[model samples]
Target: MVGEKRFRPDGRKAFREKEEFPMTETPLAARDRRATAAATARALGAALLVLLLTVAAAAAVSALTGCAAEEPTDDGDAAGVATSDADGAIVVASALCSEPYEQATSTNQIGFTVELLRLIGEKSGRGIQFTKAVNHKDAEQNITAGLPEDVAAKVAAGDAGLGASSITTADALEGVVFSDPYLHADFSVLTKMDTGYDDLASIQGDGIVVAVQGDPAIAAWVAENLPAAEVVTFDAGVDALMELSSERAQAAIVDEPRYLRYVQVKEPHLQAVETIASDKDYAFVVAAGNDELLATVNEALAALRADGSYDELCESWFGAAPERGTATRSAGEAVQDSTGA
Candidate 1:
């Protein structure tokens, strides 16, 4: 009895012997066992098919009905009805967190961003209340209410009315509304004039060093495009720019205005050889469907440009007037302006 072989309904041997001890007959040797195994395999295959179908169905449902994880906002707290024109002041959130920081967010409140908001507010006849960011990277999530779920609905649901600072109107933030471009982000590739590196391509060689602010964007760019080049990062754009020398880093990439305002004024020897991503637009963010307030802001921007205040402010801050033809153009407006149509 101890040595007698046993079998399960699944056609697997049920004997208590160690699997290595061996079986006198293969599981498929017996007719009944073979039939049972085939049936079991069929059943398992059917079950697996059903499971896959269920998972696919669930995925489809989620794709159709599920909203994306909320875009990173400045605040995590739930908001009330966001209104563009409430009796109280509208909250304009500002900040941009940098890399190489232990904190979750940082507040790099550039003065012009706030001042520009104030100007827009004054022009729009709305009382703008400034809300600083706990972290600079924290977008106006508090006001955005996480997008495509409808930004205006959330804004009208809460007091987080607008997002300012150097907020780029990225495609990822598609559902969110953006006003006409007030500023254009032209990242300049700068090098020491003495090096004779007159363009970005001059230093695209092995062992050539490039510097950038601690953001991964530029570092990743160098890694992908300039595989032979080495990249260095710094906490500030100045630190990165400082790396540029004939003996050291061959190039540095930073916001053009930043280099123009802070570095170029003092270090006249450095030159911007080329601009990168000049088409990037910096615009005010509002909730989608908040048309009146958005139009008001856009009109205010146009007025600012028309009255020469925009160029004046740019010159006062960045030391040069913005490229007028580029900034403030909406999508179709650029073409119209270009053709004079």
Candidate 2:
């Protein structure tokens, strides 16, 4: 009866019933197909949510790790010059003072300070660039009482990492820090052979002219120590020496190294007559509160000293290793003598 033709109440001829098929081959109803499609979509949506969450977590972890790796540790590198780049290059300020210590020969800078700085760079694996903060003509013209203000200002402003113009620690101003002394020298008097002045005392008298660098301290010292002698100031030691050579001034006061280089070696007729002050210590000067830079510089200096590089530099520049522990006057005494206090 299920497979036979069935007739409706008003039908002339009813359609025959279709044959049934296996369960696997049976077509699903519209409602059942809709339910199956919805379930598959939900499963796919859950998988996609998991994948997005995993990717987000991985990105967060990577960021945190990168930040940790970039953090600097405490191995004597704490604070640095604000102007320095990531490669650790630094700018050094200097003045063209004298030969064998600091000088501008053509476009290249070659001198004791230049070589020493290069050695430091090699040892520390850092790059160094030098700039002349104090012009030779200007430094020669205006000598200040304390540390040179322009140099101090540059370092304070982060324009320079250090000042290396044969600067003495005694010349340091407020908010400036000086490294340990790498070279020591004395103030001396230079005169022509015919001047017949054997010492500083002999050259002192009324109408006797003395030429000196444009350093207020040095000028003050001359005024206080030699009250009877007339003082003439020049822009630099070389200029002062020139005054003596030209016979414009009977005597010249300069540092020991300059006396040895310019008078003894260059001008054989000039002679160093007397030692005025013997305790000047030449060092690199940095802005105050830059402890990290100071530490690194000291470390490099100590290494140079230990490895005999410092001695080599001294010999190359001065023809011998510099004498250490020499007796000299205190800073106060020196300043007082210069200021006539």
Candidate 3:
């Protein structure tokens, strides 16, 4: 029987003997599996966070860049894209609407600003357009009041355009850029022919009230200079002239061109005496940044003066050629009486 029962040598099972051994699990394997899972999750989270931060950073950069580039700068030199709040029209605004400078019926705006700008437009191959007021004082009021939104708006928005008016003093030169001096206006005090006041000093404190056309700029200067004179105000030059002629006011302050124009037609008894020549340098005021357009306008004005077109316009208005030999004439030189006193 021992020979028949052949058992395995050691711990063997072969239908005669059976042996079992213990299996010990490794702690390192379990730990390694858990660490791998954690690492994968962390990698995913970090990638997602990086994506979110990149997106946010891009958004912040976009926000920092503003819309200023899309709009025209305040200077009138913009030949590029124009701001489109209004229609795409280049509007030229002026202070004169009535006769001599401008009229509803008259086509020539020669002596005044409208014609000069119109000529500039014509030479530039662009039909210069216009928006007119009753007078320079009216235009100034419109500028201050913001009545016509587009013309005033361009100035406010700092676009490449300007309104036609005199840019005379340092204070007036603050907000707008001035063109080359196109004309000079003589300042004078108008009084009834019978009024004995000969000079500014004679009229001061003489109980002789002076009528001034309601131009705050000119009026302010007059007020500062002539402290003793009582100033009466009027809506327009005609009204001021009427006041002086009617003796409602003893005197009125007016420019020589307008005064001479008035004396030629209206009350001949009204005498405009030389108190002080306004010595005005009339210019176009463009949007502050448009130095290029200003330069262009100046260049064109110079050309017009050289070619005799400006002289022709002046001759048409004053019945004589421009004595200054240029479009600009100083008020004092143009209006001084023959006596020079």
TM-score of each candidate? 0.55, 0.62, 0.54
Per-residue CA lDDT of candidate 1, range 109-188, in tens?
Answer: 34666667667778777766544343223465443212222333334344356665555665345435787877775566
Task: List, residue by residue over 1-341, the lDDT tens digit for candidate 2.
Answer: 23667788896547756566523533457668888999999999999999999999999999987653332112223353532434566567766555557777666888777888888877777876666565344456774322355666667666677777767777746556888887787666677776676456678877888999766667767777788888888767878888888888888887656655564346667766555555678888787888777787889999999999988886676555544322112111111222122
Model 1 weakest lDDT span, ten residues long: 327-336
In angstroms, give how far residue 242 of model 2 lies from its true place: 1.5
Q: State the TM-score for model 1.
A: 0.55
lDDT scores of the candidates, listed in order: 0.59, 0.68, 0.56
**Order of candidate numbers by lDDT, starting with the best:** 2, 1, 3
Off by over 4 Å in 3: 1-90, 95-111, 132-153, 156-160, 166-175, 194-205, 214-229, 318-341
- Give the TM-score comparing model 2 with the true structure, all chains together: 0.62
How well does candidate 2 match the true structure, expressed as C-alpha RMSD?
A: 18.3
Question: What lDDT tens digits, residue by residue, belong to model 3 across residues 1-341?
Answer: 22234547884655743234324448997799889999999999999999999999998877665333223333223443122224333445544433344444455344455677777766654555444423223644543222223333445344435565333433243445667777665555666655676545566674667888666555875677667777878655567777877888877876555565566556667664544534555566666665665676788889889999887776555444322212112222333432254
Q: Candidate 3 clashing pairs?
A: 74-158, 75-289, 75-290, 76-160, 76-290, 187-278
Candidates 1 and 2: which is better by lDDT? 2
Which candidate has the highest TM-score of all? 2
